[model samples]
Target: MYFERAHISDGELLAFYKALLYPRLVEEKMLLLLRQGKVSKWFSGIGQEAIAVGATLALDNDEWILPLHRNLGVFTARQMPLQQLFHQWQGSPLGFSKGRERSFHFGSRQHHICGMISHLGPQLSIADGISLAHKLKKEDKVSLAFTGEGGTSEGEFHEALNVAAVWDLPVIFLIENNGYGLSTPVEEQYRCEQLVQRAAGYGMRGMRINGNNLLEVYHAIKEAKRHALHEQQPVLIEAMTFRMRGHEEASGTKYVPPALLEEWARQDPIQHFEGFLQFLQLINEEGIHDIREALKHEIDREINTALAEVSPPVSEADELKDIYAPAPSPIPPVAGAATHDKRFIDAISEGLDQAMVQYPNLILMGQDIAEYGGAFKITDGFVARYGKERVRNTPLCESAIVGAGLGLSLMGYKSMVEMQFADFVTCGFNQIVNNLAKIHYRWGQTADVVVRLPAGAGVGAGPFHSQSNEAWFTHVPGLKIVYPATPADAKGLLLAAFADPNPVLYFEHKALYRSISGPVPEAPYTIEIGKANLIQTGDDISIITYGAGVHWALEYSKQHPQLSIHILDLRTLLPLDYEAIREAVTATGKVLILHEDTLTGGLGGEISAWIAEHCFALLDAPVMRCAGLDTPVPFAASLEKNFLAKTRMHQYIEQLANY
Candidate 1:
């Protein structure tokens, strides 16, 4: 029913007035509730209602919108049930996030809405990702993302804009240029005369308009959407508006000039739109009064109904629900599956080759991955086989690409991101920890994303290139961590990670890429994650290790042939394989945990503590660990050899076995 027209109608003008007024009234009522101690917090959109209403209404119903906390009109204009919105704000279980999140902290796939997180700029990349999905499917749809002037200062904002421009993604990057960002003035924010000018640097269309003009915002967004979809390129739009209230009720606006407030007050968007409706003879002053009363009554009833809806009793089950979706039902490996010898990297590459064929919607993104293959050649010849679209080469924007992966997952595509080095994951840490890992737990939405981390040492790659930082992500919830040692596991576990429905951090040791070779399945197969491989059973000490440490354990067993050493290869680090760990500890009665990460905060600390607590009576010796020194990875070979825990644990374990 909403269409972009050259000539306006009386009915359409009245509808816009109503749409603008609705969120204004709702925000006002929410503030009153906050004063009465009924609502927890409020971010008012009193003067800026026009921006949300205009843009959301202008976009197609099936298209997506990413709105910030101040954009309540985005929800109402999209026709989301008022009761549900109220219930969400009130943190009631009947709400969209089931009270797991509050305010605009949740998203609804059914509504095609992705709510904004506190980090304002990451969603720019997410919008780019969703737009990427539309382009991949050849669907003529566009996504609109909103941010404030302050959010534009984030590096992710620049990264996202550059990525969209390069890929020609169909997304509208709308900067809601509210004069202040949490009391910070526009003069202090940036030196540019206007934000839209930066669009030229990224090679995109740019537009700026007075956000107080509801008609202007509507028309601009409609045209921007049209341009994005038809031209197959993104557009940057800066809506020049003012924040007429405090950032939140608790944060008063003492910094804002009284004269500035008065200036913007006279330009109130809702009042101006209502005046247009009256002038058009669509509604009189008395009719305006009647409509306001009706809207107020409807909101009051919706609030009351939401309040009366009982919040479900808190339970432990609620606390643990949906942290992960069910692990994808895996394809059964053939009984006596045909096998062939392949290097560790070859197996991984082969597994990905089979995966690309199996999942047509699968995407592989990294730096120089397309025609050049990859930095490590793990994706050699992938572009020629899968085409440039599926096998993508990304800019040096780890943060944005990770966020885009989540966006792809949102639109029902499985995504894989290759971090050039494991230590480089620090660049994309926020996207991984705050965004990807927390999305599922906050909402019911799970992402099928895999980040391949080339981690480990002994290759003389130095600190930045050689790091086993899988422990960093293992601490985060809603993420699965897997590290494989042998060629077979390198292949099987990679396939298994792709099969899992949650976000997975797949760590591949650079040291084992070619050094390790074994007979691996010729066909696509998966090894169940969280299940340890029992290398050998012995009555002596149990060596609990993963990744490169598995090879260390095997070598130690050979050196100390007299000692009965039981080596357990923990392929999946997150799940811990508790049953296998218990079995190993019970059988050996002594435990040695080893890892390449530093001794201070490595995963071995947790594993050692767990074994100590659970298997105390069964222990013949104290649970010990051998991990890297508490310092940066050394650059020199002698120092690196001394810094590593390769043979340090062997002597202690032999003593313990003898003891």
Candidate 2:
């Protein structure tokens, strides 16, 4: 039937109607499941389905969609099987997450969909990276990112939009303004009248549309896609809509006024669109009823089948698998150890150069890394050697940089992100702790990104620049933490981090960057991530340490040559080599755990506790711990020396030796 009243073709209109009906039907079934205590929770995009469906339909099938938790319509448009969707909600083995993640926290690379994180805004920056990959590959594709009006309030939202604008990336930032951010009204969320208005500040074109109107959303997104693909520009589209239901099934809309709810019910997107279809002679009342009944029946059959399937068994061993990407095959160590000395910084730069040469997909990104060679000249001449595309100089946006690296990793590129200083990693902690660390465990995803942290407290860079924050990441599971003390270890561990199939936080000591020099193999070598280096073997006491503490221990042992102290340099903190630690303790019968981070919650406590529990009999005295004072690193050299336990190590070593 040709509908003269509707601008869209009959086929297009029908597809749009079915897309809308599918999610609505599934949402109704989900609610029924919730009532029957079959499903845990659900975030419904009831009135906002048009925005999800229309915006997704506007994109080409080859383009990527970074969906939000409520974007069920996007999954439907992407041809996600109804059975899989039901299985996911039912926590069955057939789901994408294998019952590991809840709700829409799963995504399929095969489907070109980046899964949603609980922290919704970080995906925007990741989408920017995906768009960047598309641009680099010279592919005529755009990445569509979906988020709610509430997500715009997050700093990541601004960071992502700014990066996208600055780079002219092909990304469409679609915002579903559902009037409330989990019961908090739009009036309280932001001062701007329209959410799209904020895009102008980021140098992007912005538009506002009626999200409930399918045609308006579809056309707006089509224009946005055109701008992104052709002009390499990002566009922000704010779809003004309402949350017809509560935030989730459990969170009822008691906060919503009855009058407002009643008003929205009258302007329901489905009913309004159905009326338009009727007016266009495309569908009558009987046909609409039949379509609804068919959709309901299909949804019921899928849900029943999903419920009947057996869920995957969860075991401790299964949980432990894939925590770290399988380690790459070991490269045979070069014959003979006598080699020319290379500075720590030189070793690191060489390692990066070698890794990039080995893997064409390896990309380096950070502030001032390209022309300026980074803050410490670690990446000096990298851009000139590798070109600007592979060695990117990004703005001073830590979270976005990390998130972009995550996106690049998802796109089959191994990215190394340089945090100008370790302390500044706090800015990107959300991406590190939540997204990068949890993605693998949640959905068996791999984020092969290495975050280079120039950490420690010796150069008198003060509190902001000098920090040994390895403990922070060591506490997080699914992350490989490596702190290399010497130039050789630095090069080897960095290469290993790039080679590993997991997210790695490589802590490079800032003070030792130039001061430390040692014979590093010119050939590329990888020091296993979980292994420790026995710097010196003695019989009196064992000093268990890492990073700059190795230097301190060496100096202390040199000063007190009478004390037979064995020093074990723990190169990898997370997957600690407890065997080496036990060997040292058994050989010496005394233990001293040391680190540069603060004493209270430093890695020393964990090591000490482990030794106390397992190797308590081997210890002659208490497992002594000497770490930095529990205070911010001071500025003055004298005070900084006192803040760190460097000066006190010798005193403790003497006391332990005498005892």
Candidate 3:
């Protein structure tokens, strides 16, 4: 009944009408720019303005919004400047993404908005994490995440909803059911009668409404927000509408039937809302004409101003900026016999414990990490010390864990995520690569998150459990990869990673968890990420390696002291210490690069190539590499021994020494 009348105040009704008009005017201008070859692309929300405007207006100012490409009205409702949007479309530096991204792929930290990636549903899990942060901070604010009907089919959607429901986080999942995903109709996408029905499986309330009715969308979202904030629960609202325009400006609607298009056009939300405003006498025809003309003039002026502005300069220095946060001030090393000789696992646990105590904003999330102390007992006694609130044991969903960590990091929290096994990281590869690795470069935002990967093979864990996957992440920019070979380095690097303002991937060799023990500092200490440690010095040859390869090199050196070999442990894989590498290569005049990862396409290849290109004159012989065979790790111990680099390092060193 309330939907049949003017439920809001006269002032608010007029404001909503203005919000509806703002996007239509701007989008029409964008279409013109596309036609004139000024803008690259435009994803119009012409028919579904009500859903974006109503849902966004229902939120508090402190609340956050994770918008999709089609939700331009959300930005309009937030009062984002028209010039900024036009500059973004024009690829100018004044844009939110600093000209790094194009249309609809930008966000504002000031406005508490997140940019969208082409990957559709990952933002949902990220919103779940932000909502968790709000709940933990005891704030009443809720986060609203926008996605299309097609996104509901992604596994991340189910994982996000389940996590939010389990934790009772204050998050609102708004699904804009616009009848098609690009071109495929909803009937072919899912067999369910309604997509909102899936919410029952996640133990959340679900609501479906006529998305074209602006008043119904507004009221439904207001109620959903109330439930999320007051009850500390998530709610899913499906606003049924249709995409009147093509997916983008260049995409024609040839796939959509003419009769269906006519039916949706007849129910346009802007026209319907204008009729309602006139019926309530809130505005007259003259007033409507004034509003439309004023918006058009304002948009035209902004577009012209943006076009007149100079574009951002392209430079070689700009290519290197924001790849990593500035290195923290050096901490004085504590001199001692060692506070305690601890195993690798104990050192890592102690490091995490000390970091949690040092920074209240630091939180830990992983499977069986809280009460169970993790599968490897690395986090033993953590929950008892830090409580279940900070030390959270998440579901067996890697993508959700990583996505939520990214969300928490965005909200000024340092999150440490643990994968049950390093091999399981493949499940979250999309988030790690697309979102975590690109957030800073794409939008000038920090993702202060650390992912702990238990890696290596030696305990007969087989292929699934044993993997040295650091090489997979080294190829990705904006990511710092650390491989610690000792208890002390493990403790130091973990602390450093927590303090860093960028995303870090820490690989802890599973074999060294207990087998390796050394004296560690009693207090927190940080080892610079890009610096490598010179394990031993000699003149015959330089053995370059990291992780388990460090141990193999040490054993080979000790067994063949007559060879006088030098070993350089590369702790950080991405920001490698080229100076240290050059020193090693120059000193020995012969080099051998070794790693535990597979031979072809391994990190050793990069190091070897660099040595060949930069240190060619310093080399006495061609650089050689000893690494794992190009095959999956066999389950048998006998077969595994032959598959590793340890078997061939000694032989390769002898041949290089003879040369």
Candidate 4:
């Protein structure tokens, strides 16, 4: 049996069949544009039209839809203007993000389609987040996130399902198994025979549907949405569809077997649905032809409108804008808050407590955040203090943890989520890099999330646990990377992050948690996020550093009394303190950079290059960099010391001495 002959009504068949045809032909037009060289790339939802259009028809106009790059049918059936899609293909700025996003990668905050995430599995977690927000906000809206079979391999996919299941969030996770992920088949992608089987691990109901059958897809989505909204439990729908085209426009069907293609072709969602419509007798042959032509004309008109829209021109200002939303209420005067007589960890603990109070919507969610108090006990006592509702102790799913944070933030809550270790943040890379960082830029500030990581390499925590990956987050736009050197800065930065409209990556140095104690304010306060602190003022050399580097620089400065050093601690890395850096390097005439991250593509190179470009005339010597050797931080305390920047800081001072 090529397709399932379910109890689908004639009227339903007609509606679904027409849906399949209209979108298929519209997608074909896009293919023509691609062959004509009018579009750069084309990813048509050819054979898999039913899953896209059918699921959407069952969904409310207001329900959130997170489509993958291949769900072109969703856009076509949902009446997304064609000209805009064409403009996106044409690489026109006007088309790229008229409001939400370009063609295949799109979402509408107003329409409740939370933007599309180009990176696959992240959207699944984000869908959970959006669903969580709807529950918290008491909105009736449900979130639907789609991904391919290959996306299930990502940690984010599992994380999302588990979290949604645990919290009973209103999210529908649709797995579109199109047989191949790029060139890799579903069999090669996973050890599990059926992708839906994994849902049981999360204690969620899972269903598999004939993806080419519009009726099956529609009913599955409807049932999934019902479970999400009424039961408040997440549902996973595995739609076994086929990819008629290659992965992308440039790709060919050479890798796929002709027999399988022909077999799936008979189950062609569009053609099958068209035949179903004829069987139902809803419309004659002429009526179907008229509707098809009407859709083409409508799509063409939309495309033209998209072409006429305007986009911001490429300029240096585009780089600066949207990094940080106007700080919530301008920075108050530096009126000193009362100092709290507490230990470093105590200060952080109290600060987090006070932060939750100040911002009632703020939540503390992470693995063991409620009961175990996090791996490092940073979130210890939080669950008991905030209750299970706000202080959520998540399963050990890093991708879901971050994805849930992103979703919680979207619901108007300031979600402070923690990764047990900085090294583990890599597991949630799809959520962090693609979903959290780009959400604001793509969907226009729909998600305001804060991700806190216990980072750096001083802890003899071994290779997997000890890593400084701040440089990775810093590279992504729309993310604010903060590495607080002091417990006071940690408290202040975390507070500021809660107030931020954009996403913030607050990296706390693990070694500095208890080792470094400082005067923490008893009163609520937030330091300027992007501003760098000029700790020690001297004229000979400028030491540009951050995180643990700030502490190391101070140590080096103390050891070298004769040498005059100007230490600039970049509190924020993404929107660097370029103005302060330019002034300091100009005044000092010599520059020395330091960091604990790997030397390759580290922040040191960027600062050093900037000085060479802007402070060339002020320089008495070339800008020097001191960073960890390009190797994994060794486990032994002594070996780790030699492999990290703290050990090499003195050597840098010696280099600055000769210069």
Candidate 5:
């Protein structure tokens, strides 16, 4: 027999009490383990357990949640196995990260939680993507993400909130105002009096609530979800809570005033919630005591079992294992298929058109990509055909847009992000390199995203507008890089990029977009990602190149016909077509690695080193490199011509042939 509580049943209140109690017991035990040297570090959410517990319980089980480092209650409240959580903390083999990561630094797809990286605010945009997927699929699901008062200072914080509001995505951005960000005081973090005010500025409803009050947090989130799902709006919530301990155990709390610590200590959330329940008759004093003891005992047993279990096995094979998930096999191109001449840009556009008809789950996101049809007009009129939901026009928020694309892929949808110019990708570099690239290796989650990089120089667009940045992404693991050199390959490679389950950075040369025309397949097809296309063959010297340099190889061959060059177009930069490279090197002992990027630290350097190690004895000459000069792209055509690898660099070819 039980009475009603504030807008919740007595049973619900009892549920809240148990939910809040477990995380508290676990945090206290973690702190003990930290001192005892059983655990290396701990992020204690001791005083603010209610925020994580209450918010998680408020959401539907199927809805996604991205929790921060300090929010362990989200995991416990979801009923994630206690042993698995302990394993994650202790770096046991049974951990979410298979013991590669020690804290709540990784996420569980089964638990429907996306975990945050050290770059705190990036997860906000990732949450935007998960919600975007739900909205696109017409699923009645709202996504919630956590951030700290200090994390609000990040650029991603603004971008995520702005995009979510602009798109009217079903997202709940909860800001845990713990009053400090790694010892930086709240006063220093912002000029405004409250974080919620910024939400209004973004044209979204803003709410500020007492985070320590479990019922208030639960009700607020419950209502926020309702508003988001029913009305298709995003809400920003500022949960007023306190960080009861150091940012980590290493960063001591000596900066805080003694009186403030005492005040917050007296207002401990677990104690407050216990007292409130006692007053409501949801639980008597004995019930509260029994709950804490039982939870503590449960944690104690789980920790003991986890402690005895072995750590994850470490091996070089394990280190190199599963960086990229098994890519989808490419749909082979038709044999002797009917073809018509088309521009490089049109071929790309056609590929996207066919991919859309195929994937249905494919989403296009970038600045001005919908109605305006993208900067280069590659997606021109796409919004009319596919509609705005699928052909999304993102704001100038590159970071959030890219993060949202990652979220879309996490939920079994394929997404393409057009970085207006490849040079502009720096804005979203962290999301690409750290989040998208590392996600598969870090947590066994494949990021099925295709980032369309409109790259290359010689377009007179200058440094900001023109850059061959394929080398940057190629350096990172867990990403596929494709650089198509012809209209046919452009269409075929794009289809391939979209088909691949792993993340792909497809580089399309700006200079070749409309300037070049060739036969392209009328229907959808895919060229395998790692394979190279042999444009022409010769025995004297092999010129290995891709993208704009492929044209360079063809031009050099026409200019110096007597030399006889084997021109190879490496459509894929990463996975490097080493087999073709080896064959080229073996056939003609003289090889020249030509590229459009800078001479130093270009992909050529890595290719040269690789060839030297494997195919050195076969070489008749030093692997010559003719590349763009190491300087910012000059606007002056005269200056840029000197910077690029042109036919005039015939000396290198002659020298290689003679040697």
Candidate 6:
């Protein structure tokens, strides 16, 4: 089948060559900077420059692009300054002196190049959702997401492709088959001979092209973009290219077979494309030499100019610059008294009902948030109460569900994404981490989104449904992690998160949904997102914990009369309550940190580090940490108990008393 190409006029062809030449020169300059220890690390798309240049030339400058780590070529084609790009690689605070962010997480709203993600495959889903948004908004823009062959292994790739195809979204999935995924070759990564065939499974058109051939790459991308913009159908283009450099500066080609490397080098995209230009008489040898020398001098001058620019002193006070959009006239907790009291499930239902009444743009989406009112029935009667538009059900794809929420949130919608079970959150981790958690930090605080995960291990849910994985998110900056233990706190935190300027991961302990009931106000309310709640006060010891552990610590305190256990219920885990913890630990002279996550890298370790550094002298004993065993939550009920740390409160108290 013949596919037509658009936007490859002589002017565009020249532009593609110019873009490739410019970026290659800068890449070489940056490589020298790395070797000289001026830059930290880099992943260069040295040999595959044509694919990036051609794809960008075919793409609309106003449209969105989500590139993977080895996409400096695409970024340069989009006119990202080589100097700023170099400043980023050099580990200079001036790289992001505008805010606190990493080098690779760069995206200019003005340029419409949605930031790049270091992780693999997840960007595909994000690109799909953003394209869906453009369609919904009736815009002509299309989205292009690029990844390696190895990224196809990720379930997110399948989820995003399925959604894009099913909805006929305007998105192009660019699979740059550069022979290998790091050290593993494409053949080893998938049994299929051609990566484009994978698109057929998603009901999308798939095509293969010679990525090393500049003309072929340009024509293929143009065809893909034409189909995307006009038909509004997703297409997958598998460009057979070669990786000429190591995965990163730290990685070496020592593991690669010498013969294989030699053969691939013969088909290097730059050399192949340059030869093709000569064959077509598009440019002579003198033109090629002039372009190369001009690009090198321009890049060299840019590097010197950027380096000469003063590095703004990084101030500690500036740490809060883009943490979250400043709350517009603080959303004070509702002043009215509680008319009715209920469990966590009822509180969430009531909060959603209230939000629908208040904000017309608010949306509730999850596996069963609409008809089922959520798997745990938290949104029970929501569909009937607010209609399907406000309360929506989604396909089983968690990544797409969350990515869609992010898209809606970007369009000024108050979107809440629900994960039926916290343990299953790994399915959407890429969406949460790569897109939602870091969006505001990357975009300079323009994103406001909320994701709710029903977490904690209980009720014999087994490994797939029961887990307390809050620690994984707490470790990430620019994401607010909240865990509410009671019905009142749950409702308050949910409202606060909606009002919050940044993305929030609201972790609702599944066991506490209906297990614990409390008085909840009907009006709008907000409990501070980062502050800890002192549930009880005592002298001898302080039990610092959050979520289900707070209730467990209280129970232990009741069981033991000798130990006066002060319990601090940390509602928000990310922006930890260091001051409150210090005061409590200093007053009590001892500390015991507890959580439900696995012991290693758990919240307890972070809390222990804080107490050790801040309250060392007041310690009666070394801080004690009690967490789940470092193993998967088991399927068997008895084995699950063994894996969990329930009934350890009494044992922990006894140990603390002895210490």
Please report, in order, the local distance difference test score of every candidate based on alpha carbons.
0.89, 0.87, 0.89, 0.78, 0.88, 0.78
Model 1 lDDT per residue over 1-659, tens place: 12234577767777888888999889888988999988798888889988999999898888889999899999999989999998888887788887888799888888889977899999999998999999999999998899999999999999999999999999999999989989889899999999999999999999998898888899999899889988999999999888888898889889998998999999999777777666657788899999999999999999998888788887777667667777966565798989999999999999999889989999999998888889899888998898999999999999999989988998999999999898989999999998888888787888889999999889888889988888888889888899999998988999999888788899999989989999998989899877889988988888889989989889878987898888999999987798899999998898889888999889998888888888788898888888998888888999899889994886768778777
Lowest lDDT sum, 10 consecutive residues, model 3, at 1-10
* Clashing pairs counted in every model: 0, 0, 0, 5, 1, 0
Per-residue C-alpha lDDT of model 3 across residues 1-659, encoded as one tens digit per residue: 12544468889888889988899889998998899999888888989998988888888766889999888888989999999888888777788877789888877888889988898899999998899899889988889899899998899998899999998998999999998899888998899999899889988889998888888888888899888888889999999999988888678789999999999998999888888888888888999999999999999998888888887688668767866667686464577635789999899999998999989999899999988999998888988888898999998889988999988987899899999999999999999998999988888888899999999888898999988888999899999999999998999999999888889999999999989999888899999998999999999999999998899998888887788888999999988999999999998999999999999989999999999999999999999999998988888999889989999887898899899
Instruction: Give candidate 6's whole-model lDDT.
Output: 0.78
**Pairs with steric clashes in candidate 4:** 17-273, 82-303, 83-302, 83-303, 129-407
Provide the lowest-lDDT 10-residue window in model 4: 94-103
lDDT (C-alpha) at residue 622 in model 6: 87
CA deviation > 4 Å runs, candidate 6:
1-13, 31-42, 96-105, 229-231, 246-293, 313-330, 356-363, 383-414, 430-447, 462-464, 536-543, 549-567, 586-609, 616-659
Candidate 5 lDDT score at position 21:
85
Residue 341, candidate 2: how far off, in angstroms?
1.4
RMSD of each: 1.9, 2.0, 1.3, 3.3, 2.1, 4.4
Local accuracy of candidate 2 as per-residue lDDT tens digits, 11-81: 88878899887898889888888989898889988877888888888788777889887789989988888
Instruction: Indicate the residue-level lDDT of 160 in model 5.
Output: 94
Deviation from truth (RMSD, Å), model 2: 2.0
- Whichever of 3 and 5 has more TM-score, that candidate is 3
Candidate 5 Cα deviation (angstroms), residue 84: 1.4
All candidates: TM-score: 0.98, 0.97, 0.98, 0.90, 0.97, 0.83
**Shift of residue 638 alpha carbon in model 2, Å:** 0.9
The TM-score between candidate 3 and the true structure equals 0.98
lDDT of 6 by residue, 1-659 (tens): 12122445666556667876777777788889888887777887887887888788777788777777777777887887777777777766666325344556677766666666666766777686677667756888888888788898877778888878876888998988887778887767999878898887887889999877766777777778888888889999998877778887688777778897798778776666666567767888999999888888888898999879888787767666655566544365556665577888788767767777777777777787877777877788887777876676777898877877766655556778788888777888777877777776565635566888888787788888888889889877778899998888888888888887678899988888788888887777778888889998998889888888888888877877777878899999988888889888976887888888889989899889988887899899989888899988887888877777664656776777888
Model 4: residues with Cα > 4 Å off, grouped in runs? 1-18, 96-103, 138-141, 190-193, 304-313, 319-326, 333-337, 457-459, 556-560, 598-600, 629-631, 644-651
